[model samples]
Target chain A: MAIYSYDGTFMGLMSLIGFLEDKQINPVAICDKNDLVTDLFEEQEDIKTDEKRARELIGRIVDHICEPAFDRIVYGFLSQINGFEMAIFNYLHLGLTAGENVERLAGDRRVAPLRRLSLRVGREVHRLKGFVRFAQLADGVYYAQIRPDHDVLPLLAPHFVQRFADQHWVLHDLNRSRAAMYDTHQCEIVILAAADSLCFAENESHFRDSWRRYFQTIAIAERKNRRLQQQFMPRRYWPYLTEMAERVR
Target chain B: MILADSAKYDVSCASSGTFRQGRANTLGNATYSGICHSFAADGRCISLLKILMTNICIYDCRYCINRRSNDIRRTLFTPAEIADLTIGFYRRNYIEGLFLSSGIVKSPNDTMELFIHTLKLLRHRYRFNGYIHVKIIPGASAELVHQIGFLADRLSVNIELPSRQSLAKLAPDKTKESIIVPMRQMAGEIEMYKMEKKKYRHSPNFSPSGQSTQMIIAATPESDYDILRLSEHLYRKMNLKRVYYSAYVAVNHDALLPANPRPQLIREHRLYQADWLLRFYGYQSHEIVSESHPQLSENYDPKVNWALHHLDFFPIEIHSADYEDLLRVPGIGMRSAQKIVFHRRAANLSRQDLRRLGIVYKRAQHFITINGRFEGGQSSLLHSLLSERKIERARQLHFDFNDAPSAVQPSITGEL
Candidate 1:
């Protein structure tokens, strides 16, 4: 069985899709070069990042199919993280094999694993944005700690730049111990320990008091479903939710 | 995972289309803007990023997707990752806000620590001022739920099942004691926040958006009436934000559990209608179902059914019926009923006016009178009218389910 590999990018996955469309070849698996590699398939095809090829492939899919579906297939391929390039190749192989009656033919057996991957990646990306809580350091630099599902810190810097375009802050993806520090003048990624990172602002407590109070007020009590609550806002995440610490022992 | 996680929070609990704006650019347009899908794995849908801090579990519930014995792939995120991702998605406008949930990875304290770290990082670290909803891990120490209430825009915990016996059968690791105690603790703190806010302007309010919970349907033998009755009590007693219904999917096969996939979408749909009636419409759980009425008709909606059961109230003159009377009319939803009240202040409404107000005169005409005249022929024909209405509703719901992208949802706990 042949292994189709990519340069571990979105376009790379598309190029593989292009290959599946034109040929009847069914690659046994897809893998990404970034994660650990397996010795199952000795033969590997790298979907080179050709600007023209990638564009034409994506355009072809969009011209005929849903753009989001095409994107999902690519992202689903990425979520494999391990042997992703191989998975993408297989997924595309299965998708192309289904051809027109695609959704019906593939069903849960092929579609679920891929969609689940895209969803997993998308959900983690969204949750980290909400759960990443920062505190003030003595140096006037804002510092925060987080433990993420993936090595997501690298994928998250541009957003901080866009949102807090004017502010100075430090966001440490605590799981990886690497941080993105946006100083007023420049932004750099840094790493720090939980012990060395404790710092505060003059009104840090005051600001938290306001935030904590606000958090308490908005939730409608008439709808308290603990299981639903735990499913979304799991207990493990409480350490990072403020106010819990405010009244902390 | 976000779909799975939506089961954790009630805020993202919607399953329909938004108001239809023409596709200025796209091919199709939803009448409603923010209806999401249900969890197929759990029959919950909504465009919510439902996920866990970590999937490791201390208590293995038999019905849960993240239970310990299940070998489903598990993952956890750093606070930075949760915060960063939320902002990025928010900017992309793919989501409304963050709905953060986690499995107990370690001790309750340790688990809560990570939760706070992520929420704080999202707020303080990322400076992400957006919709953030979190859960009050029930077993954590006292100050935990109290503090969580302060940080979270909305807070919640799951009832899981309606009764303690059911929960015990499927989820031995969880206890009503551990669950209800923290929930009560958070409720008290939030209530106190309101009290303090009035007295001391400086006192911060806790859980400002409020708290909500989900009850898993089909996990137990609890009937719709039983669920609605329980929902009524929760709403009145707990002052809950929303009582979410997560139709149970058989995640594990246990002797104590059935492989119930979910309330068929219709069942889920009916419950939502029943829930809306309880919350918005002036209908009591008893008015819809009782010891005499053990279940919703499933054929006619609870409202029409209510109208059928009580004929004395029918032929209610549009110009004469009070707000409560007008609310009882089939096809006259809360919005329509409110519209009628406002419109009637200027002029006396007639049968023509009810049709103009977007009230489905087909279902309501039999039960309501216009000024002094009732246009709906006879009460006997009303029976067929009721059954026909059921067919129409089923068709609409089917069209809704069929038209919606199936890859993202199943037709149960959620869809939008």
Candidate 2:
């Protein structure tokens, strides 16, 4: 009967859901403000993001459903898949009522879509954890640029922060114009207007050359299988991989 | 690069099995689920910085690229140099950690001492906490082996050959006793340390990721039965974390080894599949292979072959079967079986629901029934359809056609 819109943030979506439940109205669709495509038959309303309501709903979701279901909602929101807002709406609607039994309905249509989105997001997060290639910049900060299909920079910060705790680094997502900067002690996600090209350290090329040579020498010539290599490290990731990068000579 | 090339034949590059959080002063951490930084052209994972400390060997193993008589460029990395390289790569996110192996320069004890020195530099001087998988030198003294175990996350000793006779023929200086005695000692020590840690909270860890070993396949005339039996023994009796199977690639030619050696990649693939059945699927080796069928089926996977042989086990009701029974189906993997068991408790599963639950319905549809409705057509002709699908997959992967060394061919699947 109605279409609901928000400001395209996770908090905004959570607030809109909380507002809808309190009002006892089920919208025909839920979407971000920028993504709303109004239909002639349905009335549209934009919900303001309420921090208190969003936090309360999130707390309730973790307490009632499980921590994993909360993670499912967070990752599904990051996936940016089409109709993910509605999928989360339906999933939480069932989850809040069914309590812990929501996840047991894995094959149910309402829950399966959100689960699939979370899985896709999780797979990308795992792949990027390895695929991220860092190069030492001129100022001693290690910098890496990635063009991942999903918004996964927030998910990747904790891993790199723990692994490279003593090093300064920046992981920039070129597609989103955002970066996660680690300053030897803490990590913060920041927005960048335009991430320009960086100058490498004097001996940066030496290590890169050594790595490329080592990569080539490590493969057994008798079992050379490009298809399998491509399957694991897909061609989309090859542009940034030092080993898979085209030889300049 | 020369050291890495010398050590490339080692196929075990796993960086899993230990979860160490990063300390305040340390440089790295480890995850229980391993991460592959990159895949090589051979489709193998390049997890850690897999390289050798040196490429100078005293023994002349015929199948080894680093044998004493072979004329090749030899290289040695100073302990400081290797530590520096590992730290640099770790900071750059190029590797999980280091997998350090070496050719015995003078003696086993000396080589082990050298490895321990590098590990000490990494652990104490550099304060590195990442995963390190070190190779235990066969014939090393027990004290030295125990010293290295405390510094590394995982340890391994390459059996090199499948059997004692093959070891005698190919690696004349090595013996089965030399290889296995160290393996047994390491297993016992790892067990003891685990028990100690269970009681004591602050006990220093000793090879917390446990031990693994590798054996070369097809270089000697050992059947798949011989190789898998040894792997099964290592898993059951030795409490090994993993057993890697490396198909013979003709790096060196000698009278004792096969001439014009075609790498038995397909056979290696089948053995890995069979190895999975043993470790994760609760299958015994004898059930997979025996005196009658010494080799696995080239036309079908080990699970599918077992399913075809035991036809009475099929037509399992997806709704009513236990988790263990669901795993016996050819295509129902551990994850899918768990999902089925979890979801079917709430409501009945339909044919459509199986696909949504992540089942490879193309393969599972033939073995399972939905709501007591048996839809797999003509049980007698089921194997042909499975074998045909497998052959089509093999063609797509471009696994060599001539690699099928087994006597059974696709034409015989109807009889099977």
Candidate 3:
């Protein structure tokens, strides 16, 4: 399987699909590998930044395929952080094989990567449904922060922005070094001083304290599934869970 | 002819329903204002003000975070605070509406009362008419439920588990009663309003947009078959708008729940896929699941699974299969199924033409043939292919992004 590399952005990935259209060369599989390895002779390659190539890909996609199809394939590659080349190829292959008959092609084998990514992100969003915490800044920014595995910050912003849009708020995605900052008119990205610049509000600690106590009280010891718990919320995220840390101590 | 389909949808993304559309000189994220800067799967924008009313819940459902015993940060929002916040958001156009769910604080009625009050203040006092989706606590009093409908646009009560036995084991505080009673009553109220409006031409609308419910899968062993049965009942009996299947994730290491938090999303996907069948496909749960496979098939979708299990339904002459029979084919979805029905009315359909009607040749080819030309896979497929269904748990996602994998990793308590 030859791995293809792109600029590692959504548009760049789309541009790669543009390459596929331009050359009709569908690579073995497509994905965006954060860690790119150039296998000198093991693979035939293309770097997708040329404007002409990018335009062709976008043009072919919009003209032939529906707009929604590209969105999923691109988001899947980004979310799973899958092999971008494979991800791209699989997406195009699924679309071409299925063509305008998009709905029926929903669960085809080729599109499994994207479907899995959707389900994975779906589960994470549900888990974090309860985990999002707000820290009232000294300056009254009402800052909340998260460090999700995928670039979930972009995914999660609309929820908080809609809920907290009335107030100036900053939801910092520390992993990607960006924040979804909702101002008076629009929400944009901001980089914090560090995670430390943010502080819990006057009532925030009380809330966290209450939450810690609540978390400890709910578990049925006999039903404890450490492995299952670890699997859903990798122990990595525990550092930021108020209740879990308090209970451990 | 593969129409190039690249997929992207961050699952954690929600399109905001903040009603920020008509705010005058005031900052507000429109109730539906979370302008889906990006549309995720299910074909909706990925912008919405999604959050809980407060994380403080008196009910300790084993699957939930707001439960009393869960060691998580908890917060409470006063009506004034939420109203002020919503107005600020409305001015800014940051969201569409508020998705506020809460733990059972004090009692179901109390929590529901608080939620209703917050919504009321957002509406009457602040004169805000954005989208407000309040959680109707399952065991909440009838009056509270009624008041909630009057205040909010959409109300939902999560049917967290499929069966009562499962609910008791994992979410001890919740029962089938605590969950379904409100749904039943809310359904009645909605029907009442619908009837009154139909007859009198005008009446107080109760949940005009209607009620919705959610189920947590993989928290218990109820098969997708069973889950679909419950969903079918909720749809038919409860008259729900949507029955959301939130794949279960392990927030706590609850012995009663799955040891791992990752939900069987393929199962969840199968359920949703089946759900579309029931709601739109003119099929029933019993039609899909049987004594043979009480649980849904892990490999293929319910439709494809059904088509494969019963070859008799196969090759329904694409040219002759009635609209309903056409739908029975594995790869034919709502659009394609209808397309074939419509196009065939005009002329005789052909094998080459099935693809034009939107049938995925691989999955549908065997089950359907336009000119009696079969395109089924040659392989005797084994059980469903299992790509890692390892759901990323709450443990990983619910953290301070600032808590990097460094010496400065913040403690799990959401502290700096």
Candidate 4:
């Protein structure tokens, strides 16, 4: 069987898996179109993203398997970790054959890898939910910039939308160069390179300073454990945290 | 900064158990699973904007930094100032919400009135729907307590010291009756409101997140038995959502208080671990500690210690044992026990399968047997192996503050 490649979009990956299952061909490897190589020793086939096919496969997974299984697949794909595509394909292959029993096989090697990757993405999403700090922009829109490990913008969008329904806010994932913009009525994800030009509001610094003071004073002096503090709130995330970040200008 | 500094000693920063969705006009909302916006230098979760309304006091609580005898700077924030600060910080996602605590200024009734006014400003004028944790001052009238319950998400009245004698020594002004009265009143009101909501849909919630209280540990001569037994009583009788144990940090020099008292974090950690057992695990106060063993072992965790003492309960056949039985095992947790039960119904589980299900096989191997094949060497060996990990961990990671095997927590979810 030839190696299969598809567009990197989640829909494209689903379509590729659906096409492979239908053809009864076990591909050596499944990869994104960008990563596909024209090897002289091996043959490669490129598949286009099919919306209907992807929807049908997702519907079947939800019906035959469980919604949580489908959620695992989506989250695993979002992880963008190394060789995640193949791991997800294997998970899906087992899930399709085993039906809902695939969940019971959480200990199974094929299923466990996907579960691990999905949990990694889930944890990062959970962390960024609290880690993401928004500063009021000069235009009165709340702006936050993050560089999370996974492509968790889509997962983080619904939470911020529900929590900040009446306010205008933008959650910018600097790692992926994508932003989720919300304007009270609607929320949309768009590609944005940088937000260096935007200025913070006049009172933003004052509030930030107060938060910094609160953060410093809240800690018990005798119970000072910098190691433990760094363990919970890692040094990598300190750059963007309002309390941890150093004053600019 | 002054208000926050005075309020820093309060360890209850939980913002969980209340779900208030954002409305058209509201400034914020509460999440059922609380969010920690930041972590402090002491490895504590910075969930709420913990601050006092005022630090000026009429009483002399020896352990408190805001005691009347202290020569420290005292400050007070107007109700409008607190409301503005809460909204300002909330809009920037700097905090979960306001954690309004105050020292006794004039009387508990006057202080409670001020709290109610501040809460009203946040709830009505500002239209803030987020989590608000209010400190219910002891000796406050039931009328004032009833009114404030409707405005806040969670209410707590700090017990401060463990025993009545300790209360007398450390906080003479705070009588046992004064504290328990508000707690009992709030618990009854919460239960009544929960019942009322079933009958009338629009019935407002009376502290939707329920009530929690805190007690300072290690300052007095109270044993682990004394603290845990009191916690059990509070949980059963008052129906408290949580009982926080703050390690005594000596900020005051008093003959009654411990001299140069360092915050007993390890003891505090062990108490929290035992607290989890009491709340989540089906362990009673007597089961954990008794007159014979008043103090918890500094070496092993409460669970491990329990497993070691009860030898006959070990060698539980994984295939035959139920969920509750599995929970008693050294390595098996609630999540892992559930997985074992679920998986064994479909197919036979192997040793490797148990490991995959998130069980600490090294710890659990002694307690459980797979298909009647015991891998645990002997009773004496089981005891050593169970505590070996904690011993090794203590030696290697001395700075690791949390008793949990996992990484330190950023949010106080009140989990085991």
| Highest-DockQ candidate | 2
Stretches of candidate 1 exceeding 4 Å from the true structure: A1-249, B1-11, B14-48, B199-202, B261-263, B379-416
Mind giving the per-residue lDDT tens digits that candidate 2 earns over B1-416? 88999899888989999999987767999999989999999898999999999999998899889999899988889999999999888888999999999998999888999999999999999999999999988888889888999999999999988999989999989888888999999999999999999999899898999999998888888899998899999999999999999888888878788875579988999999999999988899998899788988887788877876676688899989988889888778999999898888887888778887778777787688898888665433444445677767877988654433232243245332
lDDT of 2 at A114: 97
lDDT per residue for candidate 3 within B246-364, as digits (tens), equals 66666577666668644565777788888999998899999888666687755456776666556655666777778888778666777887877666654566665666546765556
Q: Report candidate 1's interface RMSD in Å.
A: 17.6
User: In candidate 2, which residue pairs get closer than 3 Å at backbone N, Cα or C atoms, i.e. clash?
Assistant: none
Residues A99-189 of candidate 4: C-alpha lDDT, one tens digit per residue: 9888888778789899999999999888888898999989999999999999999999988887777799999999989999999888999
What overall lDDT goes with each candidate model?
Answer: 0.62, 0.88, 0.61, 0.87
Docking class of 1: incorrect
Candidate 2 vs candidate 3: the TM-score winner is 2
- The stretch of ten residues in a row with the least summed lDDT in candidate 1 chain A is A100-109
TM-score of model number 1, chain B? 0.82
What is the C-alpha lDDT profile of model 4 across B249-295, one tens digit per residue? 88888888887556787788889989988987889989888998898
lDDT tens digits, residue span A1-249, model 2? 689999999999999999987787888989888967867888999999999999999999999999999999999999998999999999999999998789988878889999999999999999999999999989999999899999999999999998988889999998999999989878999997554567999988988888888999999888899889889998888888888879322
DockQ scores of the candidates: 0.01, 0.79, 0.04, 0.66
**lDDT tens readout by residue for model 1, A73-147:** 655653545554544455555554454333332223455456557677777655655555566666766666667
Clashes of 1: 140
Task: Give candidate 4 regions above 4 Å deviation.
Answer: A247-249, B379-416
Give Cα distance to truth, residue B356, candidate 3, Å: 3.7
Q: Rank the candidates by TM-score, best first.
A: 2, 4, 1, 3
